[model samples]
Target: MIGAMWKGMSGIYQQDRGIAVESNNLANSSTVGHKKDQITFADLLYTNGGMGHGVGSQSVSKQFQQGQIVGTGVGIDVALEGKGFMVVRSRENPDEIFYTRAGNLVQAKDGFLVNQDDYKMQGLVPQSRLTSSTNPADTMFTDEFARNIVSTNISNSLGRIFNINAKTTDYASSAKNDDIAQKGDNYKSSQSKINDVDALREDYINKLKEYQLTPNVPEISSQAQKSQVDFSSKISSLTSEDNKLSITVGNKTFSVEFDHDGNINQDEMEKLYNFLDDSGREKYGLIDPSSIPTQDDIDNMPITTPEEIQAKADRQSLRDNSINAYSSAKSLVKAMQDLSDKISAYAGYSSSAKSGTLEIEGLIQGKEFKISEVELNNEKINSTNIQEAIKGSGMAMIDSAKEALKQAVEKADAKYLEITNVLDYADLNTIGMTDLNVRLDVLGLADKDVADVEISDDGFIFVKSGDNKFLVGRLSTASFRNEQGLNPAGGNLYSQTDLSGNPFNADTMNTIKGKSLERANVDYGTTLTQIMVYQKAFEANSKSITTSDEFLQTAIGLIK
Candidate 1:
């Protein structure tokens, strides 16, 4: 009877242990990364031929099966897929390392990457400083180039004006020479008129001598008639010579027909002189007759006076200025070209390429990632569209250049706008990513602090600092050879024991970020059925004990 009671007590103890295991699994059903425990029972040593002593509570093992993966758009909420645990260390105790399947991460005030329990994640040390090679200084530099171009253009025009002014001075000097030649012609005509008058006086004196010597009216009258006949002949000859003097000068010819009896007919001479003078002046570009000096004033006149000379000199200076301007323009253009190259370098653009495509490369967690085209969301950008924006005059060109620069920057923005870290098997080229601080603070030139953090399925950690993003680190995952032998530590963590094999790196294929944790493997319905069975088994054991006790009591009563 005592042995039956002892057996009943052992059954109750084992059942209680089973109930405890089921209750624990049920209690942690909502816990993240929680694994359910299963209780195993073994029969005690056999005492009789067909009877066993009692039940023994065997080992309690955990079911390491995967739960359904759910997506939570949050960047920091990380979850494991098939088999792995994130390695983390307690901030309070830096040397203590714990393995967890939960991936909810955040940046502590001290800038350490931590999980929900303030456990620091274990991974490669993050790069301290990073320089984003995006073109933020392009606008300022382009404006400078435009200003130089404007100055160059002005100088080039000045050079052209200077050449025109030199030609103008030559024309003015020619007019002056024409005026002097006209004056010389008038002086020669006056000398010829004086000589003709002298000749006439000599002829009169000779005729007087002839008349005095004869002292006869008849002789004088005959002589005077002869002289008059000769004079008329001379007059005819002079008029014919004067008509021949009228000749074609430039494009037109004119005739100055003198009177038959002439003492050098002033009207005919004046007409001839005027026609030639006007033609000469017209040929020299002296179209303003009023501005031209007459034959009488030509000796003292000049085509360009001292003031006009100074004006020509001033024009020459302007020409020189224009030349200087042209030279400056050349220099400015060369400088702008150099500056353009520098700007391209600053913004990670290659001017050497004939095509508009520029390679945009950035570092994420110290790994270099490159994107061939400037694009976002699969949209390719046209360089023509960007260049089209840079049109117009000097200042307008500056604005245009700025617009072009902005478009170039947009290319960088598009290439790395979102925090993408998952390695896509479909497209290998689309594997680049950027974090909040890396894009906003570093590349975007923002100054805001970190506001959030995110981890991808591939274990890439991104920190959001004040609307900016930075690739802080990559989360390292570990896999144990004997996961079943892992000792459960409190707070959804597991510790490696001698029985559990040392943790090794987990394959990335099984890891997924932005997913819900694995649900507990416990089935409440099964646990309830087992509990009922245990209750019946305990009742049967107790009944055996009670029947044994009653039989003993009846035997004692019969002996009395």
Candidate 2:
């Protein structure tokens, strides 16, 4: 009777525990990155005679199931479409790391990552090689990582733009600035004073640089013939008291300097500096008809392409022309060699005054003769005659050589025009050289060309961003696990958790739909089904308890 009582009592306990576990799971069904918990019951061990299985405590085991993502426009709100747990700091104190599926996250007053639970988030600090170690901070960003990411262009609606650069020791967030990209914590070199070694090395390097400067090195002109207004270069710095002439010549800008008084030597620098307007004439939209040195100016100078001066060329062709001329000349070389062989025989011995049947490869010395198969007599012969044989394989070699020259001139003139025509455009020295490469260089090609971008500065961003030929938005995607585990704090964001794993930050995940958020993976139908099961299990356990109590009461009554 006691054994039955103990078993019945344990059953009730298990039922109660089961209800709690089910309730908890049902409650968190909407939580982001939340994993579903499964209720499990254990049988209690019994020692009485023919002991029966007695229910122990019911416990819930969390499932590591993945969840779906819901898209939201919030940039900070992250979700995982895949498997992984986000690491979060404890709410009581964020320093302590704890794992949770609840994606509930909030921006803590501190700039570091945080969730709605006010738990600090943990992510692997990028490893750097400033010194050298496997440690994350030791990891240096690759050029690709340095890409400027412009999240949004400021519309008429201006909001706080935060510039967070992982490059510095501190994180800075600005409320509202014109340029967010440049607002990050400034990263200055280590403050350790320069030691003897550093100073000495620095000085030595400067000396070497001075030597290598070659300021007087003749500029390698890529100009083609017929180029006018032979464009040269001007050197200047903005800090040198010079009216730093950052002029955009033709869609390209170049900076030049003058003197300490912010004045330039008019005679030497005026053309490169004074020619452009100070109001960013070419670069900014303020000017009408930007890009000086139009196409016409190139046609009249020492800067024109070589073809423009082909009429003046006397010796031969340029690089490609020379190479081809040599090649064509090679094709005729073998023919010339054969003619020489025949001519040598004829020179050695004419038809020998013997109509003895000689086949004549050439006519020499004003005598027409058949070749009597002359042989080398180990004696020297005039090379001029041999050359004539090669030309037309007829009269003396000298005469034949003359004719070959005529053919060569004719063939080369035509070929020269064709090849030089193409090479001329590419040559920077051509008279009509547009200096397209330089144009790009001076026009801020390096700074203006960007992939993903954000504009936070004054109204300048929206206007400046559209000026260049940049792509729409950088392709990107974000991934997370256990949508239910995620605590969908307000803005589509889910905090990190042990079960959910860390968020796989999607920077151009090669997915579409930028400025949008992924939807949560929670299935409403499935959750409702789970709810019904939980209710039924609760009801069944309740009945078991009630029945056990009544049975006990009967047994007690019988014993009395």
For each candidate in the order shown, give its overall lDDT on alpha carbons. Answer: 0.43, 0.32
Candidate 1, 1-560: lDDT as tens digits? 56776787788788778778777877887676778788888988996698888889879987787755566676667778877787888767666778887665666666566767887777632333322212333211111121111000011211110000000011111211112223212111222222322332233233333333432232111100000000111111332122221211122322223222222223433332343334332322222323323334433334378986665555555444433333322222222223223322321122211111221111001112222232212233222212211112322222223233223323322111112121212222221222212233332223334446666555555544432234445656677788889988878788888888777767443766553445555567876787677677767766777887887788789999
TM-scores of all models? 0.46, 0.33
Model 2, backbone clash pairs (residues 3+ apart or across chains), number = 113
Candidate 1 clashes: the total is 22
**How well does model 2 score by local distance difference test?**
0.32
lDDT for 149 in candidate 2 is 18
lDDT per residue for candidate 2 within 1-560, as digits (tens), equals: 45555665666566656656556656665666565556677776656775666776554545555565565554345554444444554557545444444443343443333656565555322111112111333332223223221111111111112111111111111112212221111101121111211222232233223323332333221111110110111111112332222211123222323332322222323222232234212221212222223233434435267865662242222322333322322212222222222222221111110111111222221122222222112111111122122111111222222222222222212110000000111111211201111111122222232232321111011112222221111111234555444443332234556665545543222222222333334456765676576567557656666777788789899999
- Of the candidates shown, which would achieve the greatest TM-score relative to the real structure? 1
In terms of lDDT, the best-performing candidate is 1
Q: Over all chains combined, what TM-score does candidate 2 have?
A: 0.33
Model 2: how far residue 345 lies from native, Å: 68
Model 1 misplaced stretches (Cα beyond 4 Å)? 48-50, 105-107, 125-447, 465-468, 555-560
